[model samples]
Target: MYEYIKNPALIHEGPPRSATSMLSKPRVPLILVHDGGGTSFSYHLLDRINRPLYGIENAKLHDGGWWDGGVPEMAAHYVSLLGKILPEGGDILLGGWSMGGLLSLEMAHQIALAAREAKSRETGESSESSGTSTPKTPIFRVLGMIFIDSIFPLRLAELVGPLPEEPIILSGEHSRTMKLKDKVDLNMTHARMMVRFWQVPRWRWRDEAVPVPPTILMRAKEFVNRNPADDQSFVDYTRDLRLLGWDDYDEEHGHFIRDLWEVNGHHFSIFDHKYLDDVTKKVRKAADKLDPPEF
Candidate 1:
């Protein structure tokens, strides 16, 4: 967990320095997960959002640990951490960019599961044959979700078609060279491998158990273009749907996306200085619709 303090007044000196002083306030915090690069450094640039902001980076980046599971397992691990981070659990807005977005969705799902289990335990206490009651865990409520240019992995093949026979390496031999000593590079390699082989489960949104929160998709205005000669960009190909490939999936599942807003740049450049303001503005608009924090 990394804290990005936009307002210096939020911090206070104490016997032991506390990194979570902002979280102690009545305001609902916004937690952004790391992208495929396994780092949340980019989120630090979003200093304009008028809320307490925190970033959840990959543990591997700090403790030199490795993740051996897929999205569900990873989300469960983060959810457990949140239990301790905010002992007096409260509502929070969750979101992420790219791979982080997918992970956030899974995290929200796991949180809902925990809430359901806790509710069941409370209701079933009277029927227990042995009169032993298990304590319920405090679950953090997700007020909403903001997906920043996150693509649906399961629909990638269907939307983009088959990969070309020849590998498309931008920098030729230079791209093949791996920086073994660099932790970011190593983490990126592992994350990409996991993404490539990941089998996204065919899970449906169960409104009874896991009610979908207010969700918004912040899509990039420009499409990703790899080949200069290619005339058709992703935007052109996906013009009919206008969702960048999420339309069909959103409809098939639960139609949870309440709105879709286009930011100023392409996927990679959305965070750049030239376009970050527009992204921040859109995020603020979405955040305004969320329910107020409950202290």
Candidate 2:
């Protein structure tokens, strides 16, 4: 088992790299971003899964403010922070739920751009002369992505309601007694950013826009509405995503999504004990594709 760190200030304990053993170098880090709540600690259930896993919570959680940054800004910020944590020339895997999933995709796209730029620079420096030569930059490689029941062009306003005085989650230990006002502020701020990101015509990683990396989407069987007015039919939602060019299934050996697993629960409840085992196993299997087990 990976040693869990307890920190009141941090959304997640320790860094991406945790000790697996003294002799073996830690595996590539699997970084999971936070949902709209801005706390990655919600993924505490994933702690039982073996791998170098780290959660990227919003900076607002650490610093006192709401995250008003758009998708591009948020991705860049995460990339900058990640540069310090991820090992140079090491593999990286990104995953997230809801808004976090969308953010993760953008992050992967940015990382790909950075990797390409790094390679091009190195190639240019090394070559005496030539534009035809391909330079390899192994400094950073994205293994893949994992998106948990995420939807693009997010309509989260209807869903984000007044926060309860008491914490909703009983499983994981939380730091502070959150106020209703703070919760409302965070939700509104995040929703605004989500809308802004949606309005952008296209995603330009560099000279070329790129699709998200090969992803494994863990979809909930149903979309349960906590509030009746915030209702969207799961079937219709899936169709909309497909129309937006979201392919949740693998085809041949190309395009973003590689696999789709439907878990037995509503969007929020999918990560609970009833469905977490299946979700965790699938994730572990995906990790194995990048680094095969020695045993």
Candidate 3:
């Protein structure tokens, strides 16, 4: 049980951390960028899975949007928000679930460009013309990525939808009010968003170009969509990700957060079939890989 609330403006609580400094000393912090849709309370649940096992802390950007800024001007605001989550002058691993994962990839690309510019300025060499490798001024020493039931590029329809008025969820204490009609509408909405974002430019993060950091991706098994439940069929989700330049997209793992070594699924899967244990166990194992420096 990670103690959490829906919004930061909650009643008579306590002080909040400045965006720049939410981490603790001697312990590395994980920037957990959660997806936008409903209230961010779900991340409170996500927080529980992380802090206990890793002995590290994490925080969610309330009402976060993956586009770039907020929901409206996401593309522009994305990098700056990324700066906030990154370790200030330190190597901080990036983790994203659902839409947050896609945004993390985009931000990594931006950081790469910034490094290029800084090198050019320092050495008085024109990076564009020189065509030589310049020193990398990392946005953060992004080590590895943890993907929880996400591959945004493949599922465009889910990302472009405007923030839902009411949070759309498959499993929640509040799911009692959810109706079949809403699920149908959401499916249609997801289709349009994916289609529209199709033409949007894609950014690739290469292991050769940057630090070649390691990566981790988790996919849901039993959890299928209602409409095109078989939509992800025949898709070697890992290969598609490899094309995107990530080092690994492991599917040999289980789903849910409370398992012994299973990779967690999408945000909704957190509430599916007592799966949280499975998700947590996998993430812990993936995280443990960093313990004695085993890549």
Q: Against the true structure, whose TM-score is highest?
A: 1
lDDT of 2 by residue, 1-295 (tens): 1122321122234223334453244556678877766666567776444566677766554332243456667677777666556434577888887667777877776787777788677777668565555544345667788877776554443444443332222111222455635654455355444544454334354676655567877677665764668866432355335422264222322556767676667766767887777777776777666554443
lDDT by residue for model 1 over 75-122, one digit each (tens)? 777776675556778888888888788878888877766777777766
Native-to-model Cα distance after best TM-score fit, residue 237 in candidate 2, in Å: 3.1
Q: Flag the better candidate by lDDT, 1 or 2.
A: 1
Candidate 1 off by > 4 Å: 1-26, 62-66, 129-135, 155-182, 197-209, 226-241, 292-295
Q: Candidates' TM-scores?
A: 0.73, 0.68, 0.51
| lDDT: worst 10-residue window of model 2 | 1-10
TM-score of 2: 0.68
How well does candidate 1 score on lDDT at residue 226?
Answer: 53
Count of clashes, each model: 0, 1, 25
Q: Is candidate 2 or candidate 3 better by TM-score?
A: 2
For candidate 1, report its TM-score. Answer: 0.73
Candidate 2: C-alpha lDDT: 0.59
Q: Which stretches of candidate 3 lie over 4 Å from their true place?
A: 1-27, 36-39, 47-76, 82-87, 125-138, 152-195, 198-208, 225-267, 271-273, 290-295
| Regions more than 4 Å wrong, model 2 | 1-26, 62-68, 87-89, 127-139, 154-185, 199-212, 225-230, 233-236, 239-245, 248-254
The alpha-carbon RMSD values of the candidates against the true structure, listed in the order shown, are: 7.3, 8.3, 10.8
lDDT of each: 0.65, 0.59, 0.41
